[model samples]
Target: MSALQAVAKTSAPTPEYYFQEARAFFDAFKASQAIISYRKSLLMTPAAPQALNNLRLLEQSIGRMPDGVKSATRACVLEPGNTALQHGLTDALLSAGEIEHGQARNFWRHLKPEILIIRQGLPEEWNGGPCRDGQSLLICHEQGIGDEIRFASCIPDIQKRFGGPVILESDKRLATLFARSFPGLTVVEKVQRSDSNPPTAQYRPLVEEHGIGRYIMLADLQSFVRPSLEAFPRTAGYLTPDVTETRHWKDHFRATGKQPAVGLSWRSGMRRAGARHNYPELQDIVPFLKGADFLPVCLQYDMSSSERTAIQKASTKQLYIPAGIDQRNELDRVAAMIAALDLVISPNTSVLMIAGAVATPSIGLHSERGATFLGAKTDPWFPEECSLIKSGDGSWSALINEAIPYLTRMLSKGGRLK
Candidate 1:
C-alpha cells in the first residue's frame, strides 16, 4: 500500500501518527484532509489548543472565519490564563466584521501594556495619509492578487485625498498592471535595493528615506470607507472581448442561435489546503451539466494539459474557450464573456470575486461550515443581486443540485444579457 494508506492502517493509531498526518496534509495545503486528521487527533485527546489554532488557521485560509470574539470566549473558558489566546480572540473578532465592545476590553486586560503602547504609535486614519504637504505616501500591497485588485479601487480615492503622487509598492507581476490601470501613480515592484548614504536596513525604511511620511497597508483601505457595489455594478457591456482571440468562442456560441451559455470555474489555488476547500474535480460538475443547454467557459488559471483534455471531452458538444494566463487582457475578456452568459457558477476563487465585483448573477459553492456562519443567502462583500448557493453538508453533488433551480430562476428574470 502507499505510504499514506499504510500509515492510515496503523495497528493502533497514536496521537503522533494523526498529528504527523495532519501536519503533512497542512504542509501540502490539503486543508480538508488536514481538518479531518486534526479532528481525529482532537477526538483522541481533547483540549488541545495547538490543534484548535491550526484548525482556525485552516478555516481562515478557506474564507470561513468564526467571529473572533466567540472563538476567544471558548478559548478563555478552556484556559483562563492563556493571554495569547485571549488577544488572538480579540483580533479574530475584529477581523470577522465585529465592532469593538466590552469583550474587547476584557480581552485587552490580559495583553501586555507595552504592546498596546507600541500599537498607539501608528496613525488612526485607515489610509495613514493626509500627511504633511508634499510628503509622498507609500502604499504596500498585502495578501493575494485578488486582494490587490479589490483594493486597487481605493487608489483614486487616496489620490484625491493626497495631492502628491502616490507610490504603490506591490508584487512584480502587478506593477505593470497597476501602472497601466492608474496613470499618474508611481507603481513599483517590491524588490531589494542596495544603496549608499546610511543604507536602508529594510524595505519599509527605504520608503521613509523617500519622504513617505505616511505608510498604508493596502488591505486596510476597506476600513477607511465601505465601497458601494452599485457604483461599480456589473453592466452587460462593461468589457468587450477581443475579436481576434475570441472569434472561435463567438462563432461556437453563435451557431447555437440564442441558446443559454454558462461560464464554469471549478479549481482555485493549487496549494493543497486551498485545493481542498475550493477544488472539486471537473468530473464532479460534468454530471450536473448533462442535460443543460449551456456552453462551458473555462476560467481557471494554470490548467494542465490533462485537465484541459478532461474538460474538453467532458464538455460533449458544448463550446470550451481556452483562456491563456500570459494575456494581460484575458481577465477582462473573461469578465465580458461572463457578462454575456446566462449565469456564472464557481467556487470561491479570483473568478468568483471578479464575477461578484462585476455584478454577475453567480452561484458560489462553499463548504457547509463556511456557509453556516458566513451567511446563507447573500454575501456581504457583493451586491444583493448576486445569489449565494451554499452546501448544507459540504457535499459537491448536493450543492450543484441546489444551484440548478436558482440558475433557472435567474435566467427567467429577463435581465440584461449581451
Candidate 2:
C-alpha cells in the first residue's frame, strides 16, 4: 500500500471510546479524570445522553449541584421517557436547592435500591390536590441521622400547612429530641439497619393505632413548606434539648475549672457515596487543640475507650466527656451536652446540626459539598451562631492550619463570633 493511502485509513477516537474511558475512571475513583474524560466525550458528541447523565452523577456526588443540574437537564431533554434520567434531574434539582421546582414528590423513588415505602406505598396527598385540614399523615424516615435532622427543619412549616395528626418515625437516638421539639407531632423511634429495611414494629402500630393513612417521606416536605430561602425561619433550632440536662453538663464542665469549652466531632457513622472527603483524623486536629487554651470535649459518636485515650495523647490536651452519656445512642443527651459547650467544631454531620440548631457557636468544617449551602457558603438552616468554614480542593491539614487564627479569635471572644 502507498504511504498516502495508509495515512488516510487511520481513524480518530470516537466519542464512545472516551465515554467508556470515563466510566473506567469513575469506577477507579479518579473523579477529576472521569470528569475530564466525560467532558471530552461531550465535546465530540454534544447530544450524548449517557455521558451527560454520568457527568451529572459525578458533579452531584462531589457537591457541584448547579453543574450537575445542568448536565441532568441536558440528558433528560435528550431522553425524555427515561425515568432514571428524569429522577436524576429531579435529584440534582433538589440537591441544588431548587425546592420550589416540585421535585421532592418523586425523590424517594431515586434512593439506592430505589425503595422508600416501609411495608407498602402509603396514599400520597400533596401531589394530588388541596390537602384537607386535620387529615392523618404518616411521615417515614430516609437517609442518615444528619439528613433526618436537616430534613426536620421543614417540619415546623409542614405543621402550619397541614392541620393533621402527624406521626413521624425517627432514629431511636433522635426520638426523644424530636418529641420534645415539636409538641403536637407524634414521634416514634425506628432503628433502621443498613443491612435490612426500616423496622415495622417501630412505626406500624403507632401509624395504624393513630389511624394515619396518607404519607410522605420526611424530606418531601422540603418542596411543600421550605420551598424558598425566605420560608426558612430565623430560629436557633427546631430540636430543643432538655434544659435540665443542659444545666447539669454546664455545671459539671464548670467544676473542671471552666475554661473556654469547645465540643469536637470529627466523623460520621455511615460510608456516604463519593462524599467522604473532609472529616479529619483524630490526630489531624492536634494542632487545633495545641495552645487553644479551651477545653476540648469529645462530641464524636461511637468512640472506644482506646480512641478516647488516643484523642488526648494526640492533642496533648485533656479530653472531657460527661459521665453516663452515650454520644451516639443518646442523641438527646448529646444535644444537651452540645448546648453546655461554648463552641462545637465538627464536620457537616449530625453533631454539627445539633450545635447549629441549639444556637451554640459552631465551626462546621466543610469541603463545599451539600444542598444545605443553598448556593452560598453558609447554611440557611443554621443560625449565625453556627459559622461554616468553607474549604475547597485542599487537604484537611491545610484547612485546619488556615482555621487556627479564626479558632483563636473565636476562643478569645469566649466562643462568640461577636
Candidate 3:
C-alpha cells in the first residue's frame, strides 16, 4: 500500500469525518458500512441526532427492525422534541411487534395542530377501560390497509371482553368487508379522506352524533387484546368470510378441477420510495410456478393489464385465475376465495394478512425489509397458519427456492392436491 493511503487509513476519524464517511456509504447503498460509520460518529458524539437518525433509517431500509428500534429510540431520547425522530421510533417499535404505547401516545400528544385534523372528530380514545353494561363504543380506524386488517383481529376479542354494542369505523373501501366479517357489529366509513396525516375537509361526523359512549383507534385495540404474543386471539381465524361466497368459489374451482388450488400475490402496494424492494416481480415468482404441483391462482389485487398479460405470457406453465372475480373492490369475496384455497403464497401485503387471519395455511415470502417477517419460521401473530420464509439475501428467487421445499413438506403432510 502507498505510504499516503496507509497514513490516512491509520489516522483517527473525527465525528465529522465519520459522519461524512457514513453519508458517503449511505449514498453508495453500503448499508453495513454506513451503519458502522454512523455508530462510530455516535461514539464520538453520543447525542448527535443526525447520526442517530441516519443510523435508524439505514437499519429500517434493510428490514432490520430490532436494530431500527434501538437506533430510533436512542434518537428520540436524544432529541425528544423532534417529531420525525419520535414517529420513526413509533414505526420501529410497531415493526418489531412491540407496542410502545407510551412513546406512541407521547408522539401523538405533541402532534402539530395542522396534522390533528385527520383524527379531529373522534371522542376520547378508549384506553382499556372497563365497559359499562349496555354502553356503546366507537372503534375508529387508522393506518394503512394491511395494518387495519391486522388490528381488526382484535374486534372479536373486544366484543367478547367488553360486552357492549361496538361501532367500527374503517376506510370506506373496507367498510363492506368489515361489515361482512364481524357479524352483529356496526361498521362505518372513516372520515379521513386518505391515509396521510395532513387533514382534509371531509372529516367523518363526530362520535357524539352517532350516540357512541366512547371511542378508540383501531390500532389501539391491540393494547387491550394483544398486549403481548400470548394474549393474541386463540380462534383459528378472526375474519369470517361469507359462507355463500366461499361455496361459490369452492364450486367454481371444483368445476375447473384444479388440484390443490394455490393462491399467489407476488407484489406489495406499499407506495413508499424504494418500498417495491419488499415485493417480488412476476418473473421472479415464475421459477416457483414452473414446476409447482399445485394449481397456481393469481390473487394479486392491483395486477395491471400489462402485468396480467405478462403473467400469462411469462412461462409455459399454466396458472389459473378465477373468472369474473374483482380482486380489489370485493374484499369479502376475495377473502372467501382465499379461505377456500389449499394454500396462499404472498408477500407482506393484505392478501397474506387475510389468508392468515382466516386460518388458511399460507407461506409469507418476504424481503429483509418486512417488519412483520420477524426472522422466524412461524409468525407470532398467526403462529398456527402463517409460516414466514425470509429471503436469505436480496434475491426473490433465493426466497422462493427456500420456500419450495417447505411448501412441499406442508403439502405432503396435509395440503395435498385434491
Top candidate when judged by TM-score against the true structure:
3
1 or 2: which has the higher lDDT?
2
| Best-to-worst ranking by lDDT | 2, 3, 1
Report the lDDT tens digits of candidate 3 across residue range 1-418. Answer: 1432354588966887878877766554466777888888888899887688778777876667688888888888888887777766766676666654433553452365433545555556666666775667888666677778888888888888778789987877678778877887888776645556565534235555657767776766766776665675555677778898898887877777757788988877556555545677678788767656777888876777887777679877666867787888777778899988888888888888888777788887755533343333346666545454443224567677778876776666665222
Write the residue-wise lDDT of candidate 2 on 231-291 in tens digits: 7777666779999999999998888885877888788766566444546766767787884
Please give the lDDT score at residue 361 for candidate 3.
82
What candidate 1 gets wrong by more than 4 Å, as runs, is 1-47, 54-69, 72-96, 99-129, 160-164, 172-185, 192-211, 227-257, 312-315, 323-342, 368-377, 384-392, 414-418
Clashing pairs in 2: 134-163
**Candidate 3 regions off by >4 Å?**
1-31, 40-50, 57-67, 94-116, 192-197, 200-206, 368-377, 389-393, 416-418
The C-alpha lDDT values of all candidates are 0.56, 0.73, 0.71
Residue 68, candidate 1: C-alpha displacement in angstroms: 7.0
Taking all chains together, the TM-score of candidate 1 against the true structure is 0.64
* Residues forming the 10-long window of minimal summed lDDT in candidate 1: 114-123
Clashes of each: 8, 1, 2
Each prediction's TM-score versus the true structure:
0.64, 0.80, 0.81
lDDT of 2 at 217: 75
